[model samples]
Target chain A: MSAVIEIEGLRKTFRSVRHGKRVAVDGFDLLVEAGQIHGFLGPNGSGKTTTLRALLGLVRADGGRMTVLGEPSPELLPRVAGRVGAIVESPQFFGNFTGRRTLRLLARAGGVSISRVDEALELVGLRDRGDDRVKGYSLGMKQRLAVASALLKDPRLLILDEPANGLDPAGIREMRDLMRSLAAAGVTVLVSSHILGEIQLICDHVTIISRGRRVAAGRVDEVLAGHDRHEFLVRVAEPERAVDLLHEAELTAAVEGTALVVSGVTDPTVISRVLGEQGLWVGELTPLRPDLESVFLELTGAGEHPSVPRQVDDSALPAGADDAAVIDLDVRGVDA
Target chain B: MNLVRAELERLSARRFVQLMVVLLALAFAVTAATTLAGSHRPSEAELSSARTQAAEALQGMEATHQQCLARQNSMTPPGETDDFYATDCSEFDPIRQDRLPIAADYLPGVFSFEQQARPLLYFLIAFLVLFGFLVGASYIGADLNSGGVVNLLLWRPRRLTVLGTKLGTLLGTVLALAVGASLVYLATFWVIGQTAGLGGRPGDDFWRSLGAIHGRGLVLVLLATALGFAIATLGRHTSAALGAAAAYTVVWELGARLVLEIVDARRPDRLMLSSHIAAWLNGKVRFWDNQLCTSSSGTDPCSGFYSLTWGPSLVVLLVITGGLTVAAFAVFRRRDLL
Candidate 1:
């Protein structure tokens, strides 16, 4: 697939008399191919918005190169701007203008047919309230209007920063569906949001950024698979005995509440066979896979504490065997 | 062209511009009413009384002239002529009928379009200048402050083109409004004169002079509007333009005038912006300069006058407008819109 957007070694720094200098985006690199709904995930102040702004020419960049649809960004951005739609931040409109009037003005400015204004409004489910003044709309409705504006040109590439901001659960689902429909219609969407769950649900590809740099990026499942530990949750009537049996067989196991978590196991039959020989029949054995949230938190260091080191809990081990059967797995970070 | 059309539509839709238009209409109405109420056609009896009073005043003036001539001819010093010992007799010249004051002139008789409309035209021009400045400032100021400019840039990525189009639209609209408003103002006053006072036809020379003044007024309004837009664009907020205007007025107009007075500066009015504006509008204005004296005595203080003409005033205004506009455009082209 052809790359729709490419950013290489992009850097931007903001300087002021009071704040001195701040590196908002540092050597950040991103590549989005055509027909992919890419999710850009980051915490607050992680340079997600800065990268988007720099790419769109809203702000000048200090270093590196960026391109949109094979044209160098900010300079040649206008050439392809008609084919691309972007909303960098929460754009506020004239409060006195009706929603329809606002869209009509944007449509005229962009040289798009005015009929698309109604279509964009319908796509975002704002057609009914299109006549209402913008000041009277709720926050979610405003967000929807912003989305409607981005969809005015029926763009091939859509860049939205925090598109789900101020959206209710239902509205978020509607937005998700709208994105899915757009993607199905051959549009490449690059959506940045703090809502990792929504990103996991809708995006085919994901890029995770932290401290103004990309920490992880790939297909959602592939990124998750790199963090997967092949661990399993084992439940039995005698969890302590199961831990002892599993430890004797050279399997790392820790009793967590009512179940013992087994790690470093290549095959599931080994755990059942090792436990059944000693009359310890496992009631349940479920394989635990890593999700995007855990991997995102781990890669972004969101779960890291400054003053403390992560360690496996010795209290969860059997009483007398704690010294010899200590599992070296640092699961505290995952638990956090 | 499309962007220009959109901007014009947006400008017209602004509540502040709408309010300014309403105020302009109200001001025109008030001026017309005041002009109608202040003028009238004098009666024949009043004319007869004015003639009688002129005869009595002329008789008294002739008696004073005879006394001055006798004093000058008889009381001359040896070394000096009548110039030193007594007043010059030539101060009293051949009295003419026009020199005598008419009652209709003193009272609010017929309103002469040639004589009375210039000052009122100045008022109209002043109001329009103020209107243009404020509307131009808010036009771009509100957009930059509210991120509306950013929204427009997202649609049209050419920064210079967007800013240039906005400036062009502002200047064009101000010119159109000034022309339309001036026409209406002059027409309404003419109607008022015809209905309640004299509507004497003015000669071509008078209309030509008035037209020239109107042209200058239009230029001034355009310049003021551009200045406001440039300052607001540079500051990225409406309050910045307003603050700059207030600072100039208080510091330069009022404060510097006092400072210049204390220092006894020569041609102090030459250093003032208001004086330049007045000169530009009125062709030329004379200011009293007591320091520019050629001769003085013990009792009489030294005094003279200085005049500010149109050429220099136009240059100063153009330089300010051009400099700020260029700066605003350069900064806008490079600065990051946060």
Candidate 2:
């Protein structure tokens, strides 16, 4: 399948009188396949937004080769712009214009049908407030309106940057489902966000970037597997003895609460066999596959530097997600 | 086409512009009404005063001619054109040669339409240009302040096309408004003239002059509007353009005039932008009051204003406006939107 967005050797530098020269994106590369919801994850001040801006020709890149929907970008941006929808940073709009009027202006500029304005507003659940002026809209409503704008063209490729920034829980779920539905209908989606759980739940493919460089990228599971240290949580009668025996066997193991967690060994039966030979009965031996958050933190070195603030706060974790497991592994991963 | 339509919509939708239009129409009506009310048939006393003054002037000229003729006959025969008697006789013949009209015994029975319309036309031209500048500046200023340029460019990324369309839309709107306002002024002035006993019916010559006035009025409106747009584009903010315009008009022109007077360099006043603009609007040639007029060369013609012809006046005005426009487009095309 052809890639929807291709970036090779992309570089961007910004020079400000107050800040001197700072590199925003350096030697960055990205490939997003067609018909998939791809997650673009990065820490604060990373090049995620910068890369997206360069791709859309909002800012001219210092050096790069980029393509969107199989056409060379920025040079041919106008040709393909009609079929690509994007919301960069935050949505900017005319305050006096009604929500419906704003979309009509955009639709007219893009040569899209006027009827699509209403259709897009309906799609984003903003149909009722379409007649109100944009200045009266709340932040969430404005975000919804921005989504409606992107949907007006019924684009083949959708790029959103922190689309869930100001959304509540319900709004975020709606946005996630909308992205999933768009991708399911054969549209390629590239979403950049700090919400790791949302990205894991909605994205079939993920690309993790750090410090203006791509550290890991692939299918969601493949990226997880490449960085996954097969950890098994075993609850045995003698948890401390189990950890000691696994350590004596040259395997990385540790005790957390009442269970012993072992990594660097994939065979679950060997774990039971070793503990069983020592006259300790295993109550539970469940494989602890790394979630996207753990894999992300591991890959981006957020796990290595505990003091550096993480993009995903503990409060942003989705309900029923394993916060304890994430913290436990991060601590152990630091020691290892 | 889309960009032009969008710009027109955006410009017309502003509430400030709408309020300005209403206020302008009200102001025009009041001015026309007040001017007409004060311009009525002259009173009997005023007529007698004007006639007495005209008779005195005619009587004085006749007496002077008689005295010069007596002196000419008493002096030596004319030897050359420069001799005292010859010079006095040469000046006397022309003064007494043309027949002067008889002093009017009564004032005009009605206010003249041409007299009433000229001031009204000047009023329209001045206000229209001033207001046009504000409109043009505000149109771009609001967009820059609100960060709407980025949003608009996202839909159409051709930078030059966006700026060109905006300027075209502004020029078209200002020109249309100016023409419409002039028509209203003319219609109101004509009605008042007829109501006040001045004939409203205009001759072909009147029509021609009126057309020229409106034509020049339109050019003035265009130049002012373009100036505002260019300044706003270069500065990327409305206040900056407004501040610059105010400074040029108040500080630059007034300061330059004061400096020229202090230094006794009045000849260079012909090149002043304000001077040319004023001359163009008044349909008069601008002049420099050089000290050569007061020199001891004994040249009679040197004791008056030296006319700056229409050609140079128009050229200077266009050069200033055109240079600003080109600079604006260049900066807009190359500068980063941020």
Candidate 3:
């Protein structure tokens, strides 16, 4: 697939009265392949939105090589823009207009057929209430209408900033499915979201940004599996004593609550046998492979789940059992 | 289906414009009706009252004439044409003279809605002609200041085209609205004039009078609209531009007239909106009173040229609007919408 979006050495700064000068985006580079769901993840004000705006030609960059669908962003913005759709931040719709009418207006502006308006509404699951005035609609409904408007043109590339901002669980899932379907139809989808778990589940590729610069980017698995380490969390009856026993065995282990996480081991069977021989009854030993959630926190020190506290804050607590990743744990520990 | 429809649709997007149209229409209708009904020539009963006064004046003069005759026959030297026609009767009689042009001269003609309600001239000029530009300013300025315009600018990506389209649409709407409003006002005024007075036979200059008012109103509307549009674009908001235009047009004109009254200078240039429009309709070019407007009166801010060559006035007006438009677009092209 061709790279639908390509950026190199992008830099953007704002002349501010209060702050003197603020660089919103700096040296940001990214390539989004056609037909792939590329995740643009960043904290608020990290310049993710700024980069998107630059791509749309809303803001001129200070210095950068950027192209959309292989066309230079500035010179070819008009030609390439019709084939791309976006919702920069908050969804804007005429308050008096109906959801259906707003989409129809957008379709007209985008030079698409009127039928596309209905298609967009149906795709966003807003068809039943399409005639409702936007003012009466909920925030989630407004967001859906925005997506519907963006999809009306059947764009080849879709840039959405927090597309799922007001969506409920079902709505988010539906949006994920719709995005996947769009990607399957060969449309490049670049979405920015703060929800890491959702990104892990929905995106095919992820790019993590920090303070207006990229720090990590790659396929979901390639990025999540950091530095070639496989770790597993070992659950047993005596969590503290079990961890101490592993420490006595001359093996380095991290304890996260009741789970004794052992890393660097080649096999879980060895840990099970060693514990069994030592007169220690093991309840369960499960391998914890890297996922997007843990990797995201490890990289940015931020994660969606609140229960998963930072390891930095609770160093005394064991890291989830660091048992090395194994296909199967045939040596199941004794029943509790 | 056509561009006009699109223009109307775009205008429909704005709520204030709709309100303005409704208010102007009702106010114009009522004012026209009031003027036509109130100022119309008297009926036979009222004519009797006028006759009674004329008779009373004649009686007093007769008593004085008896005494003068007893004293001196001095009326002989006075021209015979100056002699008052002395008559006497008890019934009402029609007293007529050659028609005065003042009322019909300023009357809005042939337009049914503008009949008697000449206020349409000021009303339309105030809202329809000039306010459209002010409205356009807010449309673009609000969008630019807020986030919505930035979103569209990013997507469409051509600054010049965006600016040009906005300008063209705004100009088109202003002209169309001004013309439509003028037509309504003219029609009403003409109807009222025909019914109330205008009873004289069509004179040689009748067509000229009509042409003068029509031509002047149209030209003034066009110029005023362009001027206001440019100002709004410059101001970048609805209120500031509208307020400035209003102050310059209304307050400045009145103030200039007051100043000219004291200074003993003929202020051909210092015409505020209504007076300037009146002068222009008379085929004379006058400058606005203050430096606030586009044209400046050299040396003396108060002493501007009274009359402009018609050709130069037209050219200057166009150039000012065109130049300001170009400048506005240049700023629009590069400046960040956000």
Candidate 4:
């Protein structure tokens, strides 16, 4: 696939007389492929918005070779910006106007027809209440309205910073589906979110950053791979016999009160055959897969782990999903 | 057309603007009612009282001046005095050249409750302050704070037009208010002519003369409005912009004038826009018989009242307002509102 948004050797910093100076983005490189639902994931203030702003020419970059569509970011902003749409940070709006009126104004300014406003509003599920003043809108409704405004131009590349802000569970679900369909229709979406699990579910690729640098990038599964450590628990009525047989096969086994903790052996077949020939019946063989959270914590310097544990069910996905999911994404795969 | 309509809707929907519009209309109505309410019957008792006061005051002033002149003349040699000076005491005196504005003569005829609160012109100035706070904030400062301007900028993908349209909306609203105020002023005077006996008074003249007062009033309104808007754009903080405007008009302008007066320095009033417009509005004040004409300060840079005709001063005001507005738009278009 051709590249839609490209950044190479990008750098930026902020200087204020009162607060001193801070480096936001340091020599960052990113390439979002055409028609992919790309996820740019990072902890708060990790330069996601800064990079996106630089790409949109909303903020000047200290140094970079950045391009959107085809031309360089600075020289091609006007020419390429029409084909690109963005909703940076919070949804900006004129409080007095209705959702429909605001969308219509944006459409006219974008040189898009007024009819497109209705279509955009409907896509965002704001059709019913489009006539009400934006001031009366709930936070979620306002965010959706902003999404509608961004969609007015039918852009090929959509850059969104925390687009799902203020959305409830159901709204988030609908937004996820909408993003899928947009990508299917060949729209390139670059979404940034702190919610890593959501990115795993909806994005084709993800780039993770920490302290103004890329920590991990590529297909979600690949970023989680090698870190997907699993061990099988062997149980039998003759526990001592099983341990003796396992030890003879050069497996380091630890006693976890009742069950022996076998170190480094993942496949059930190898353990079953070696112990089965010794006339021992092993009752349980369980394989554990390390989740995205563990991998993320290990990769990024945000040392604290997420409190919620993941019940990873590899069986629910298709047979080849684990391997296929790992290799074929942008940003961080070894192949990439 | 759609964008322009949206701009109007957004401005009208603003809370501050809606409050201001309602308050402004009410303020105008209240002022008009009070100014036109008093009867011009000229009762016999009041007339008798005025005649007694004038006679007594004039007699007192005459006695004092006579005593002083007699003392001076007795000491003076006759050959030093010219026949002309004794014959015409008032001729070519610089004080005689200081003609008071005609607006002062009709000021008492204004007769509204607000008008009676003297220096109603200051209320008009205050309106500009409130108007600027509402309109300037909604257009740019609010947009930045909400990130609404960034969204609009993203959608349109043309920064310049968005900034231009924001300003265009402000200008359009100001013009509409001006025209409305003028119509109200005309209707007030018409009522006064038919009812308050202004026809017998000296101020009943060409409608154009009254219009010139409204015209100058309109300029004052736009200048304050535009200056506030420009400051708001630069500061990007509504409260800060308001503070800056207040500092310039109240602290800077008022302070300078006060210091100059204390020191008895030359040309203090020229630094003030209000004084210049005052000269322009003088002829139209219902209480003041005519515009004040002074030899000092208004027309010249150093003179506090160097005389500038209505047309020139108005043109100067427009240019200043226009220049500031354009500069404001330019800065706003380039900034990253986020």
DockQ of each: 0.37, 0.18, 0.18, 0.28
The C-alpha lDDT values of all candidates are 0.84, 0.77, 0.65, 0.67
Name the best candidate (by lDDT): 1
**Per-residue lDDT for B229-270 in model 2, tens only?**
888878778887799988986776888778877888847667
Best by TM-score: 1
Candidate 1 lDDT, A166-240, residue by residue in tens: 999999999999999999999999999988899999999999876566778899999998998999999888999
TM-score of each model, paired residue for residue: 0.87, 0.81, 0.75, 0.76
lDDT of 1 by residue, B82-183 (tens): 443233454464363224444434335667565667887899899989998899899999999888998999999989999999999999998998999899
- In terms of lDDT, the poorest run of 10 residues in model 4 chain A is A327-336
How far does residue B29 in candidate 2 sit from its true spot (Å)? 3.4
Residue A291 of model 3 has an lDDT of: 70
List model 3 lDDT by residue over A31-85, tens digit each.
8988889999865555777788787876778998999988998778788877887
Predicted complex 1: DockQ? 0.37
Candidate 4, fnat value? 0.44
State, as a TM-score between 0 and 1, how close model 3 is to the true structure. 0.75
lDDT of 2 by residue, A125-223 (tens): 899999999999988889999888888889999999898988899999999989988988999999999899999999999887765667778999888
Model 4, residue A302: C-alpha shift (Å): 2.1
